[model samples]
Target: MTVALMWEARAVAGRGEELLAWARDQGLSVRPLRRETFRAPGDRVLVITWWDAAYDAELPELPEPEGELVTRPVHRWRFESVEQGA
Candidate 1:
């Protein structure tokens, strides 16, 4: 069996790029980790990423007037697609 992992995080006063960079750095050291996007605005969005270990993530730096991290519950959908990929 295979498992897909994704992380949804919300941070105030930060561009998605900053968060993406942080995630990307971690991905450099781990496999199957990537920055997947859901919904994004100026300072709020959903980040879908993979996990190779239990998440006890330390928050990264945000933009000006930074806000604390609000770690959302990570959710994933499990399914097998056709060879062509549905």
Candidate 2:
């Protein structure tokens, strides 16, 4: 099965660039099949990683950034791929 993990965070005021850089620099011990990072107008950064594993399987995920760098705690979610319609 294919699983996708989502990590999202909002940086402190005016520090969006730093936050974006920090997210891009993070590394996972077990590399994902694919990874992508995104940013939004609210200084929010989102990272999605695809993995080949069971839905309930243990997997590595991005850690929280330093408290000083963000306005609030990070949010994360996991989802398993479903069959595509023909």
Candidate 3:
């Protein structure tokens, strides 16, 4: 099965660039099949990582950034791929 992990965070004030950079620099203990980073108008950064594992399997995820860098705690979610319609 394919699992995708999502990590999202909102940076403080005008530190979006710094937050994006920080997120991009983060490394996982075990590399995923694919990883991507995104940013939005609200200084929000989102990272998605795809892995080859079971839905309930233990997996590595991005850690929280320093308190001062963000306005609130990060949000995360996990989803397993479903069959595509033909």
Candidate 4:
């Protein structure tokens, strides 16, 4: 089964671009199969990385951005792929 890691954060008032740039420059210890980034209406940025490891396996994670750039701590989630016709 495939697994994916989702990391999301809301930037401070007008720091959306700055936060997104920071996330873009960050690197992971374990390389992912693919990665995607998105921006939302409320200065929010979302990053999803596809991984080869299982959901329970140890994986690298993105660190939180500077305090001044974000309104709160980052939110993270892990999901495992489910068979469509099972």
Index of the highest-TM-score prediction: 3
Per-prediction CA RMSD (Å): 7.6, 1.5, 1.5, 2.2
| Best of the candidates, lDDT | 3
lDDT of each: 0.42, 0.95, 0.96, 0.90
> Worst 10-residue stretch by lDDT in candidate 2?
77-86
**What is the lDDT, from 0 to 100, of the residue 62 in candidate 4?**
88
Candidate 3 segments whose C-alpha is farther than 4 A from its true place: 84-86
User: Candidate 1, which ten residues in sequence have the lowest lDDT sum?
Assistant: 57-66
User: Which residue pairs in model 4 clash with each other?
Assistant: none
How many pairs of residues collide in model 1? 0
Model 4 per-residue lDDT at 5: 90
Give the candidate order by descending TM-score.
3, 2, 4, 1
lDDT tens digits by residue: candidate 2, 1-86: 99999999999989899999999999999999999999999899999999999999999999999769999999999999997576
Give the TM-score comparing model 2 with the true structure, all chains together.
Answer: 0.94
**Per-residue lDDT over 22-67 for candidate 3, one digit per residue giving the tens place of the 0 to 100 score:** 9999999999999999999989999999999999999999999976
The 10-residue segment of model 4 with minimum total lDDT is 77-86
Stretches of candidate 1 exceeding 4 Å from the true structure: 28-30, 33-39, 42-85
lDDT of 1 at 47: 46
